[model samples]
Target: MAQQATPVRTARLGRALGPEPTAVSGAVLLLPAGEEISARRPSPLLATASVRALGRRLSRTGREDGLVAHVVHYRYRGWNGPEAHLAADADWAVEEVVRRYGDVTVCLVGVGMGGRAALRTAGHEAVNSVVALAPWLPEEDVAASPEPVKQLAGRRVLLVHGTNDERSDPELSFRLAARAKKANRDVCRFEVHTDGHGLRQYRDEVIALTEDFVMGAVFGRALSRPVQDALAAPPPLGLRMPLAAGFGRSLRH
Candidate 1:
């Protein structure tokens, strides 16, 4: 007899089904909230309210727009482990989507640590855009032979952070955006005022921007130009300006 196959454990991944059948465009790979520590928490793709709201909109619009979406549940909680496990999972998902959909466009939608993984994966050929919400920015100078988040030269990346975020510093994301811009990449960093890491205060606004950016802007069919412009515009705090480089605003603002 053949050996029995091992059972799946501590992880889940699949394509999200829509309300009903509809036309198709591209795909959205969603990585829900997570942490970099070893604590084992429930997968945010299934548990987080923010992700649920975004998922509902994506399901509806995906049916109407005929697009595909997938949510990832990592095998672990932390991303700073030896394997860079989340990034591997993301690479697999992107490859799987391309295998099924051909050489089509892709949008990476991630929150927090998940967003970090998404940013690391957005340089892949199929990925056209990335929307990282309250992302956890990586540290400077990596010991890993090849840095995972280094190939963002030509991709469209959008990062949104809340000003009052106590969990992760919004300035880190802003700094990464500035660095990418300096590298001649097209990047947008939006700062939502007075909100924390969860962004509970402006849930609707966050969802709407994610939907518009992923569905409209990524596909470049509808809601593209305006959403693109809004994202590309400097943050309201004026920190995105030239004079603000290495400024003291990050300490207070």
Candidate 2:
């Protein structure tokens, strides 16, 4: 006689880390750049000071404002070629935030592959805003998600791309913006004319532009003129451990 074993689910997902230890009023999910070629956790792009420091600062601000800042580490480097994996992961993160906080709002920010993932996920019920940075649009062969505007009618969206980007075409983003605008979305498209995909030459500008938009879109507050003028002033440095979770079977990871 043979004994039957329990069934195991086999869906791949992503990891989530939060700055908010408790139920938050709102949240922002930060996603990194990567592709099917490399689904590395905390993509190398995230290791850079420009990206890591920005995550830290954004987390700190989220804490101060009763918001949660969750950074996602995807299990697969590819978007849903047919399964919508990244979009599903992002949606799961948003659902988790709302589940804990109750009617909580959400925002998304992503770079490269993450950027496309953000758009794909923007249609989630809890997402009110999204910021895509130097997003790498997909080719015709790829089933990138539907035009985000159709899913995110009332949501706010900001697309920032570098004119000199050699890795991706900024024109694609511009066209997306136009599409969003035509759909009656609250969309803003910004161009960093001299920067490339990493936005190396204009990191500060990217940070300011994004943070400002996230605050307004989710929290209804962008920086005031005085604060904007003083953004160059560095605040005291502090550190905190992130509240880590993964998708599906290993959520607590």
Candidate 3:
């Protein structure tokens, strides 16, 4: 007899910050990065720290909008090949949010490998939008199938990549964004020049862009000129729109 595959355990939703569940008008599920291959149960993912910090910032930004933020703690520590355990964790998180909040809109925000998970899970009914920061997309080849973009339809999507990223290739994200845009015109990408996979150099600017996109998607607010332009512009130009310095500061006015 063949050995039975081990069933994955349920993912946990980290304590949220912001409005109470009963009062939340919108929610953001934050996903964290992980390794390429590992099945070890994640006692505590280091990547969760940064994403939690981001959630706190977003929670504050969307306080007036009644947006609550939750971090997803995956059942496993890695993407784990085609199983895509991270994406499954994200899906569970979305479902839990829906069960708790009932019809409230949701925005998925993730970084690195977690970004890939957010994009993969955006097809969920509760997810109105997704923000992928330095998403790790597999290179297309005979051995590796390309990530599907059809799932992104009817959902607003934003991909941010650092041009100087030493880990995940920025070009790969550009290609994915181009494909996703064709599938859903709402999809757009931004390039942070000279930064790495972490996008730390333009952290504030990236966060600002994310906040604007998430809030607009959740509350039907008007998007900034740059985002609107990027979404309306054609290929290459839209996929490679530069994230300018002081971009965050500019949003204040």
Number of the top lDDT candidate: 3
What is candidate 3's TM-score against the reference? 0.93
Q: How do the residues 185-252 of candidate 2 rate in per-residue lDDT, one tens digit apiece?
A: 36666667677899867676677666666776777775434223322222110001111121112211
Give candidate 3's root-mean-square deviation (CA, Å): 3.1
* Candidate 1 TM-score, true structure as reference: 0.78
**In lDDT terms, how accurate is model 2?**
0.63
Candidate 3, residues 131-195, lDDT tens digits: the string is 99999888778686688888899999999999999899989889889888887889899999999
Q: How many backbone clashes does candidate 2 have?
A: 2
TM-score of 2: 0.73
Task: Give per-model TM-scores.
Answer: 0.78, 0.73, 0.93
State the weakest 10-residue window (summed lDDT) of model 3. 15-24
Sorted on lDDT, highest at the top, how do the candidates line up? 3, 1, 2
Clashing pairs in 1: 23-66, 24-66
Clash pairs of candidate 3? none
Ranking under TM-score, best-scoring first? 3, 1, 2
